[model samples]
Target: MDVRTDEIAEQIYRVSVFVPHAGGGAGFTFNHFLIAGDEPLLFHCGLRKMFPIVSGAIRAIMPTDRIRWLSFGHFEADECGSMNDWLAAAPHAEIMHGVMGCRISIADMADRAPRSLANGEVVDIGGKRIRYIDTPHVPHGWDAGVIYEEVTKTLFCGDLFARLGDGPALTESDIVEPAMIAEDFFNLTSLGPTTAPNIRGLAALKPKTLAIMHGSSFSGDAEGAIHSLADHFEARLRMALR
Candidate 1:
């Protein structure tokens, strides 16, 4: 596994760890997005075992201890597995997540108390304004949610548009098709009634950049890409019903 970091948006860095031959194809990437601001926020904790390398990657941009806010899309291992590890390193860092996540898991799982954000709650982290949206089971996880960086118009959507391979850190190409292909292979998303609607709600944000957790981060027509993904899942739901 090799970890590489790239700035996908203004002061927003995508730290990716690519593992070859792991996703039943070329490989997969466990990506973590670090938002550099007055109160720096690090999204996605990677895995507990990958702490050293992931932390090292983060250290390249800012000191590990300077991170002030920690959050992720869900409570998965790849998302917040290294929760305690980060708290141990960044003494001032506080774990933030959706209300249900904190009530169900984070409040107990985390080494320290967590701040639970209500739906559509926005937290000003210095130069960046992060809005947390509750999206339960859109991709997966009952406590699933996502954060939107207002200044950058970047949506830190976890596991949505997830695909296999070591694509560039950021691309302007079509991500919806590749994501659908990966969906056919992995079937990782929890397709249900709210799946398409939840994604469509995100499209309404009209994001210019999509900070994806796997594969590549997209920087072009983000709204269209998100809507297309919703359409695909809606079609799947129709097929499943038939």
Candidate 2:
């Protein structure tokens, strides 16, 4: 089935941000929000190809001289591949990731220093709250996490439920509702069922929205989606035995 994409507005905390970028590239080119605060924040920086769009979107909100906070759910080009580029562009931008991510990026992968985040480690950016929850093995990387913004009800989900040909906008319902996002989610797990257990890990938050770095963000009944996903995994496992 062909799923059409939509790029609608999701107004949060008096901020104007782009939805997600139209897909014609390797990964999801997200709008990447520039949250207003004493020190502003930038969500997932789209793929290297999508950097221009990210730069432009960020430029709209932050001045060229302002320091920015660069963060991602996990380490990937789409999530943070262009880390060096963003660092060069925004010298004031501080690269923040959790311990595993810090280890992988600084010690093993990119080898750049970063501020490590642990579970429940909250960073008050100006006045907004950014809480990190450890999500291991969901994307199968040593360092992985999902960030929750208490101020916006948004969860900066990494690869929890990504899909193909996604729009540049955010929100599960705005483009594709939870039911369909759930379906696409299962499809992804079909390719990587090993991450099944980690899905349950995200359930504790009971997020109102599952803000995946790719595809659509599940906006309603996040725990329900997790349950449904768990059920789907069980069904798949059962069918495989038959």
lDDT of each: 0.94, 0.60
lDDT of 2 by residue, 1-242 (tens): 12222322233221122334333332332434455667776667546765665565556655744746777777776677666677778777777778888876644544245778877798888766888887665544657777777766666667655554544344544332433454453443332455556666667767676666555555677777776665565566676777
Question: What's the true lDDT of residue 53 in model 2?
Answer: 54
How many Å off is the CA of 106 in candidate 1?
0.7
TM-score of each: 0.98, 0.73
Give the range of the ten consecutive residues with the poorest summed lDDT in model 2. Answer: 7-16
For model 1, residues 1-242, the per-residue Cα lDDT tens digits are 87899999999999999989788857999999999999999999889988999999899898999999999999988899999999999999999999999999999999999999999999999999999999999799889999999998999999999988988999999999989989999889999999999999999899999999998999999998998999999999999999
Pairs of residues at least 3 apart in sequence or in different chains that clash in candidate 1:
none
Stretches of candidate 2 off by over 4 Å are 1-31, 107-112, 166-194, 237-242
